[model samples]
Target chain A: MSAGTDTRSVTRQVRPGESPAGPAAGPGKTPFSARLRRDWPLLVMAAPMLLLVTAFWWIPALGNVIAFQDYNPFTGGILGSPIIGFTNFAELFGDPQFLRAVVNTLGITAFQLVFYFPVPIALALLLNSVVSGKLRAFIQGVVYLPHFFSWVLVVAIFQQMFGGAGLIAQILRDHGYSGIDWMTNSDTFILLVTAETVWKDAGWGTIVFLAALSTIDQNLYEAAAVDGARRWRRMWHITLPGLRPVIVLLLILRLGDALNVGFEQFMLQRSAVGSKVSEVFDTFVYWSGLRTGDFGYGAAAGLFKGLVGLVLILVANKVAHALGERGVYSRS
Target chain B: MSRKKVSGLAPWEEPGSVAGRIGKGGVLALIVLAVLLPLYTIVLTSLSPAETVNRVGGLVLVPDGITFDAYRQIFSDSVVSRAVLVSTGVTLVGTAISLGVSVLGAYALSRPGTLFHRPMLFCVLLMFVFFPGLIPTYLMVTSLGLKDSYWSLILPSAVSAFNVVVLRAFFMNIPHELLDSARIDGAGEFRILWRIVLPLSKAVTAVIGLFYAVGYWNAWFNAMLYIDDTRKWPLALVLRSYVVDSNPLPTATVGVNGFGHVAPPTLAIKMAIVSIAVLPALLIYPFVQRHFTKGVIIGAIKG
Candidate 1:
């Protein structure tokens, strides 16, 4: 297979793209046509990805202009619809349900940041403390298994544990108490979702912290000990600081993703818990737009989410850069 | 947590406290149980007789007479059998397409001096922040006549910006010296990528391949969004309908053993569905677990 390419490649200079040494020499100095001649293969390689992104992402982003129109899918379509600029946004803000969704979405994001974010760090610390590498690896394997499970499967497994007539309910009944259904209760719905999120994802979250932990210089701990610093001192001074960069980066990502609080989890449970508790941003768009056929209204909500998310991500990335860390993307 | 001989504490480390170690062991045990106990009941309930499931009330704890009756019923059910095939086909095709496009694109972006590298990288990185709203994408799909088509599931979500970034990072970390030598040997970029780069990247490639495959296998929302045809539903969607929606499966298909009179419990049948949905993830996890520690950690740390 390689020999087939050797025939055409044998005599052609191919320019080698960049020499190994001083490879950072910017191609910006090269003329576009010359670079094109030398690097057409790379362009060919990237075409499919560029095409897919343009089709699905950029086009649909432009398509959000339907949000400003009084759209009818059948009659007006996207273009023929009469422009009612900002009317959809106006109505969206005025609607109490939309407001509730914003509140709920922010609430979930905040709640998870407080309660769920530290779990993997704590778990990693615990796992890292274990002296037996074999036991640690085994535990890590078992815990990370849940991250691979489909949300549908995760919910089913949770239902078997927390639903009416589920194991906990059964245990309560066996003890002569009438048990409450955990899955359907609107009051503690936040707790339930948090627990479910932790179960499904907290283990996976540990991987980054574990990686960070491994990178921390062990010699610092020895140095600290020789200076008469205790275990708590070593952890407080050395460990947490070492983890700060990764922690900051992840926290920034969580902020950027604040609006998207697990659409499928909320969608699957909407009927059971009522939309009042379950209507986060994504689910709200899905129900209002897709289910009610209010394409314009839904698109407005979606565009609201996308624009706000972009702003948040940009702001967060700026903060990261100020704090001497790379955020979501580099300026390069 | 196990009581095997632990490595002696390093001189810098404080003497281990017995109570703290015991507490850690207990907590770790609970975490493991929290995962395994649910899995145990689901699997056991699927295997148990009707009386055993009924006696336990809903989810079985202790085992009783084991049987393949539930599995037999699930396999024989036409809807489920068809769904399994659909899920398998979609996963295989989707993974291949994603891996191919992502690998090529990532390699392109990996090379620093290549034409349009910055523009291509920008195109991908832009996806990270500005997720176009779901409605327009849906509109685009419908307008393009992809409604109810399997292509709808594969095309729209095929190129993940994160995966592209991760794969690009991995490719860049490859010793450029290796590729330069191949280039000097008159190997074209394609040949170098095929013969040199890919052979060295088996672990990370397999890891990325598994990630895409799992995403495809576990995706139900796309199917729900685009597929109006029940016949085209993947296993994940089918699992959702039966388990989350708690819809009764076709009576003729469920709750009956191949032999006439031995009716397995409905709970067993539901548990059976859950098992079928979950089993693949569990089976594939151990093999991929090492890659998570290696591939995902390195990618994450680098980012």
Candidate 2:
């Protein structure tokens, strides 16, 4: 739906999440039982969702207390697991594989922030600058194709192109070039993953900026051009400023999720590149905990990731504040 | 679907240098080609007959001949066939469950004056910020006796908070007067939602539904965690084992011809499996793509 034009609703819309219902429901305290009786149908509607969320997300979230215990699902499961405070954490911090996972995760995150972040904005601008709406739409559709491909398929496609027996290797062999398989090359692993991310998501990423670009008043561009400003100057002054709010919001989100480069991308490629280069936090948890039956230790590793994520959220909030803007979680 | 456009550029914009136009065209062409060429090759490879694959001795790059033997072989293979059934069933059932719960729950919270609305919204919002660790979820699934069951694949991921919020945003945008009028006519909340709100919000609902459907279709990790039986493996897990793990399925290792036929080249069969995994997304995505930007813009505004 288009944004409302009413002045009263415009002010009210800013706090819709926190606001009482519109004029239909007045803001007055009522006894719980009375309201419950009146809203029983609505309560029934919400029951299933509440039940599912509790079972899966909230319960499992609390069950991370197993990270502190020596968990044996056969013995007592989450209920009676032996609590050995900090033992799993001790083991987690001490383990070389876990260390590698942390380092690799952060390294990839920082690398992607630098290399992969701007690509969508630039591509969106390029697409925006195109002169034919049909061509632009076709290009948009084509590029978003890979985002829908499951990571397994993405890796498979990448393997077909860059694996030892893949097209590139075959071409190189035809020219008598010795041994080149980019998929397994540890030295370029970061770049390889970054390329995969760009190929798969960069187009999909443009959707938000494209929406923002649409919101930018066309008059600003016209006025700037009328002032004898060339294209580059108009883009820098008007277009970039117009895009600032969205850019900041996404950046803050990207920071809060900084450690998550995604699991499937790394997990699928781990065998080819070896754990030494490919073991990220999620994969580390999967391999070390699930495969080896070290549930508590794996839970500890996963919990540590969550803790770091929380810290990142704080740092993101600080950045948001410094920019004189709302952070990721506020003003909802 | 649209009238031919003279230009996407605005009137105030110059035509720009010829080189700039060409460079932009060149880059856009390359981006489109990069996406399509790999897909083109895979589809070609999947269709290539044995001799053509043997001639190429790798991924088929050029089309010399065509056959559906690879698809026929995989379909005949019990493992791939079973997996396909599982994937399709899960996707449909999971999407329905997710969309059902999300719609009911979103409408419940859509009215801000509803009981427990703030707390419920806060609870759902927590999903974005916190993830239950993988081991705990596995343990919970097992404890619930859902391990190795089809329900395990569906239930754990049944609700998407983002979808719920987006739906709620759309629902709240619907004029409250309609609901009030329905209530005045003695229409209950359920009837109001069913008869009034749903028909108006079909596009957002479809977008959210597709999201759940695609997620379920592509899901493998949950299956890998919970399903120990190869018989229960979904198409994605099967794809992973066959292609990414390079493990051969029984059918892919044998010929589908009536008698004494050599198996299709592994490359062709592998590409065939890849093609099968990718085909659904390719088919369903374009129809839903245009509707999604609105869904996203709403989320951006509401979030």
Candidate 3:
């Protein structure tokens, strides 16, 4: 509450040490000794979120301990289960379905990086070239709308357009051709999913690139023009360089999330295409854990996924810093 | 990388540049048309009569034949009507609760000094990069006895890490000078948050709130995974059944048109289902799009 003394000691831990940032640090910026005043209202304000995270996020994180145990939800609690050491990991590696999921996850991620990642940059460039603000904004709005649509709606929309009974198939049948099984065809499922991801997300993904482009000084373009640089040359040398930081930043972030090939997207369509096409780490856990009621085994796979993601983020962040670009986890 | 090469000299070469402008404009127009044409066709197909739709069979590209019969049939069923009501309830209630909880937490994090602020921030960030996977979360929800209830939809998704981070970044942009002034005016942190911070943050709040609302509205997988009760189904799940399973006709007690007969799965029915699911988001999205650039990009840049 603002009713307290306005001065507080700024003896904050720039490093991890000393007292945590709390309402106890008196209201004035002063020496550390006189700062032990409790601010109840501030603590009260911070309580709900902390409680929610601790309950939902932290508790579930702690539940990952089940991965190392022969845990039974019906019998022993998460921590009280018998320890099985590395057997879960051993089992996970030995399972063919799990191996398939690993390969499938990597395969989809690589395909997306190659296919879906660059279109947004091209789109941003096209948008930047459009001199009309109204038109650009309208198009941006139209494209970005799909990002807000849930995976359910997106999958439904795709099915309505391309499924065996969908419009395209209906058209093909009318034209004396066989109805194409685009949705259910396992061979083409990865491409279909990647295309859907682009359609739903690429437009929203352009925002950062556009923001970066907008920040580039217009005078540089004028100078390029004065130097008799062609439009294509100007774009190649100046525009692309201007967008480099954002591109690198986004790439690093994307690498950090490379394994997260989305859950709801794969889940809804997995039944249609069957596991051969749709099985990924997230859905694998969902099915094995919930459907088959193997909570401990699923938790082990999930814990493995989390550790991989964390390692990716950390490694990618370090790589970015080494390359002299600010990663998602900048020191600041 | 193979890039398309420009055919002619730069447009600025020729004065009046009319031909060059027309060429580029023509290409852009065609691109826009290609993108918009499918959406237009879907809407037209949804609007046309069932008989007309079946006759067309594929897509009614032009709107020459049109009727509201499909829309009428879609809204007529109690199952669909109830699902719409439930979806609306969940989205509105869920977004409000999510925003309230996230704003409180984010505001706390944005403040310079709060107990365990850095650790709290780190925890939130950890939620973004490393997830607790579906099994444990499903187990947690089930253990909490929320399986068949609307609370299952509302509570589990009430805290989106991305939205919280975005809002926290937005809140941090608030000048410390303003907080200093508010403190001098004898206002509590809550008063400052409610009166000063929130008033200044309408754009981000509205955009993030819209994101949450759309998320809840479009959520079907969670309901499919956790919700077993047909009565509490959302429009998205209903649409999924219609689209994926291709069954327009309602089950058992519910009648399609208050008759004992079941309507066949027509293109019109499928389109109508998609149209219904998309309507809310399409209608509401433009208003929120204005806030999106500033609201989202700032967060991404900072993060």
Candidate 4:
């Protein structure tokens, strides 16, 4: 890919109609034809990625038209399928399983927001307070290790420690208590998954907050301390306020990603706990739509999730701006 | 409180009182223990003898005896060995291709006033807001004749817009005068990129490459969705089936004919598989650990 781009750029520069003088191109006022001639090499460099993104990202986006069609893969996919405006969505809305999935997604997302979100902030604060740099780095390294492990490995680790025949269960059994099926327990599965997420990601998440914390001016803390402010007072008045924008930015991003309550995690555990308790929107779309050959319905469910996420992000960004914070992207 | 000067402490930081020191120590100890204990159990259990593992009922925290039987059994099994090869191949090839495409695209996009620059930037940034739903993406993959192919795993996720954006930001930060000097010397865009831009941005490129490699290595979802043939499955998918899903490892038919009758303890095998899945990440983690904060901060703050 690199060689191809390199060759193309070199070849383009050697072509006719080349103006060798640099910056005399008059910036944005350059003629479109002249700019194209001069900059075609850059365009050539970008072509492969442009083609890939268009083919994969944009085409699939257009394929969302399947949600409005009774899409049968055998019947020529989206374009070939009969039009069924809102029927798939109506079915999705009417389906109890789909509703269950929506509820489960919301529940898991809420649990994560409430329980898992603050962990990194707390960890960052704790680590920030540490006087010894080496000790802090060591702790960060150890904690961050789990974040790289796949959900499969993480789930396996959790099962080994907590499953019916796992370490904890064996200890209980040895103490004359019956083993509990913690791994597959539906009633507590949400908690289990959330705990797993925290274990896997909390330490990794602290990196950004730690960065943000370090950027907080030392003079602010010094100024506060000069006024006879205590540690807790400084934290509340200076530290917390400094972290507020980042916290809000992350929170908004989290809300936008709420619909994605981890498909693979739930999919791997679904048969163990049964989908009745484990069905989040992603899994629901997979099982009901793709697996069952109900492509249109699955497309509708996924489309709904995506649209909600898009709206959530937009609203969150708007809210961030209202609060005088820079959201994810600027309007410009 | 005496306003005593303290060396090596920040202005707002307390010189640890005895109670405060003890409290910090306790918290750090808990954090360390929470992470280390589970890892210890996994390693110990993988090394423990079958009888010891069975005797303990599951994960062995304290091994009475050690054995490599589980590891030996898994490697000797064709399914697992093949899956390992598949994963390594996919990760290497996928990372290389992803990095190549990303570098080219990022370099181009980083240059201000390049043809279609704003629209291209807008398109990539818009990826942050919405994703094409699962079914459509799957359909697109199938329609492209990539279904059941390894390309399905690599292609769909080949270009991460975030990585491109991050790399673009890094490339843009490169001084224009350096590139202009090269350009004045008749060095083309490609030559300047190869000799100057790449060498200068090695750290960010490496970080982005690692991200791509990790993503590919850890991905089983694409395989699960695309590849139907069990033989073509990657190590992660196999690991998920045998370990996470609690399914028994498929008995090897060729190498150890009588091994089916006397299999290792299920728990030991599961632990071994778990360890195997995590081993690569653990091995490479230390080398890349320092870059995590640097790379992530660049992406987060800039993007």
Candidate 3 TM-score, true structure as reference: 0.88
**Pairs of colliding residues, candidate 4:** none
- How would you encode candidate 1's per-residue C-alpha lDDT over A125-153 as one tens digit per residue? 88888777778899999888888888888
lDDT of 1 by residue, B66-160 (tens): 98777777787787888999988988899999999999998888887576666777788778668899999999999989999988889998997
Ten contiguous residues minimizing lDDT sum, candidate 2 chain A: A1-10
Query: Total clashing residue pairs per candidate?
Result: 0, 1, 9, 0
TM-score of model 1 vs. true structure: 0.93
Residue B57, model 1, lDDT: 87
Candidate 4 lDDT, tens digit per residue, B143-235? Answer: 899988999989999998877867776776677788889988989889888999999987788778878998999998999999998999998
Interface RMSD of each: 8.0, 4.4, 7.2, 8.3
DockQ of each: 0.54, 0.54, 0.35, 0.48
* Candidate 1 ranges with C-alpha deviation above 4 Å: A1-25, A326-332, B1-5, B252-258
Runs with alpha carbons beyond 4 Å of true place in candidate 2: A1-19, A22-28, A314-332, B1-8, B254-256, B259-261, B298-303
- Report the candidate with higher DockQ, 1 versus 4: 1
- Which tens-of-lDDT digit does each residue in A1-332 have in candidate 2? 01111111112233435444432244367677777777788889999999999999898999999999998888887779889999889888889998898899889989988898889889989988875766777888888778777888888899899888888888788788965889989889999999999998888878777877877788888999999889999999988987786677667667767777799888888888899989999999999889999899999988988878767765765564566344323322
lDDT of 4 at A100: 96
**Model 4 docking grade:** acceptable
lDDT by residue (tens digit), candidate 3, B97-199: 8999888887877765544555777777666556776767777888889899899888877887767766776676777688768877888888988998899
Worst 10 residues of 3 chain B by lDDT: B1-10
Candidate 3 stretches greater than 4 Å from native: A1-38, A324-332, B1-27, B251-265, B299-303
